[model samples]
Target: MPIHIKADMAASVWKVLVEPGDQVAENQQLVILESMKMEIPVVSFSAGVVITVVASEGSSVLEGDVLVTLSDDGETG
Candidate 1:
């Protein structure tokens, strides 16, 4: 299955910590969003391999926007 890690709130993308094909563990930080002078970390909810990174550093994102896409074992097809 594909897991989409989304933003919980509207914010500017402060940093992107992971890239496509990176191995990720549960709770691993994927990106950081800065809003209202506060930095919010986006984490993976499940262990998987990053298939794509939809969010970029210094970009603006809205709530529920997909930041990263992951598959159970590095295979999305």
Candidate 2:
């Protein structure tokens, strides 16, 4: 299955911790968003191989914006 990880709220992207081809675990932090002077961590809901990183550091994002894409079966091609 392919998973699209999205931002839950409007915020500026503080950091992107994973890139395409990175293997991640469930609950692994993928990106950090800064809103109202607070850092919010975006985590993966399941283990997967990162296929794409849509959010860039210092970029502003809106609620429901995709931050990352993952392939649960470890195949991105």
Task: Pick out the ten consecutive residues of candidate 1 with the lowest summed lDDT.
Answer: 68-77
TM-score of every model versus the real structure: 0.95, 0.97
Model 2, span 3-48: residue lDDT tens:
9999999999999999999999999999999999999999999999
Candidate No. with top TM-score: 2
Those runs of model 1 whose alpha carbons end farther than 4 Å from true positions after fitting are none
lDDT of 1 at 22: 90
Give me the displacement of residue 45 in model 1, in angstroms.
Answer: 0.4
In the range 1-77, model 1's lDDT, one tens digit per residue, is 89989999999999999988899999999999999999999999999999999999999999999999999866955
lDDT against the true structure, each candidate: 0.93, 0.97
Compared with the true structure, model 1 gives a TM-score of 0.95
Residue 31 shift from truth in candidate 2, angstroms:
0.1
- Lowest lDDT 10-residue stretch of candidate 2: 68-77
